[model samples]
Target: MRTTRSSTSRSACLPSLLLRGGLTAVGAAAVVGMAAAPALAAGSTTVGPAGDYFSASLSNSATLTVGSVTVTCSVSQSAPSQPLGTNSANQVPTANSNPAGPVTSTINAPTFTNCRTNMPLVNAQVTTSGTWGISAQHGSPSTVSFQIPQGGLEVQTSGLASCHAVTAPDGPASVAGDWTNGNPASTLVFAGDTVPVEVTGGFGCPTAATQGSFSATYQVRNVSTPSSPINITA
Candidate 1:
């Protein structure tokens, strides 16, 4: 009778142990699945290869305007020395979504040449203050929206004695445009986008205007691989 009772107890506990073991195995599998989930969702938006330098040249004459005063620049360019950075697609987002940014680099101040204003400042020179921010906010596989953050673009004018002006508080200005990846070179197009600025100057300045507009097109080329164009991909 003792042997039989021991055997019966062993049989009953065996099923319980197996049931608990099955539940533990299922839990472990769930954890493993969770761990592998992120690997499947790793799409991204990237700008060229990492650490690449690039230069942008104006494809068309650029313009800077405040109210009735318009400054047309025959040449404009940005040279980026900082290494390029990468970003995830979710971070940059699409044009339809609210996008953050993948600020690639702080570029050198853009140079504007042959700048002549609608006002009498024929010899006007456009000089920028502070480092400019290069960022990608939204896009598709071939195109992305670009930004130069506020304070990234501050233009101080110097030429004639009566033609000294500056964008107040460091321009409190920004640049917004679209980038389209292409062969030979990528293109950035700024179609007369306007931002707020307080223009202060001695005389013959557009102080009455509260906003400024920039319009230009640029072609971006990779410095390292001159044959390859810089690409912004999502």
Candidate 2:
């Protein structure tokens, strides 16, 4: 009779122990599942007026300063022959969404005019060579930042014997700026951007400097449809 009673007691406790163990295992599994959940997915980008040419004109005068020399350009893109700059394909209907810029376009060099140096009796001439490129970098709803590929813009400066400089012998300089979408035209602003340049002249040159800076604002418009503004959504 004593043995039977002990056996019955053990059997009654078995289900309770099993239930507790199973509940603990399930709780741990739930926690692991939550921790492994994935993040939100990104959407694709779209551009308006697809497959159209766009030009950029200076909304403000451009300034380039290297060491002791400061050059200001008053006229850019006044005529068709002296176009400020051009970019290929104002449209990318199906572009992958990435802040690191998976979209790219070919860009031409810009011409500067009415350029003069801060130093008296010294003139400034700026020349650019090679086909540059622009790529999307990062952006928000209203504006997007772009990265101009390096080594595409070769800025060679020649003028008075006292003031001459170049970007690099084998390599060229590049820049970064922001673009804002609008109706009539888009805007590009370069606020005190730093570019690499070296001085290789005799007197009054920024011989001791290894870098140069420039600032300008440009308004972009579609050539085919002057009223259509370039729009980039990411």
Best by lDDT: 1
Task: Please give the range of 10 consecutive residues that has the lowest summed lDDT in model 1.
Answer: 25-34
lDDT over C-alpha atoms for residue 65 of model 1: 45
- Model 2, span 1-234: residue lDDT tens: 001111221222211111111111110000000010011123344455665556667766776644334556665431122232332323232442445333455444455666665554455555543443444433453333222223322233344343344443344333445558877877766555454444445443334454545666667676667777766676
User: After best superposition, candidate 1 residue 29: deviation in angstroms?
Assistant: 54
C-alpha RMSD (angstroms) for model 2? 27.6
What candidate 2 gets wrong by more than 4 Å, as runs, is: 1-44, 77-102, 141-160, 168-172
Tens digits of per-residue lDDT for model 1, 41-150: 23344555555566677776776544334556667666544443442211211232222334334455566666565534344545543444445433442322232324
Error of 2 at 83 (Å): 14
Provide the TM-score for each candidate, comma-separated: 0.62, 0.65
Best candidate according to TM-score: 2
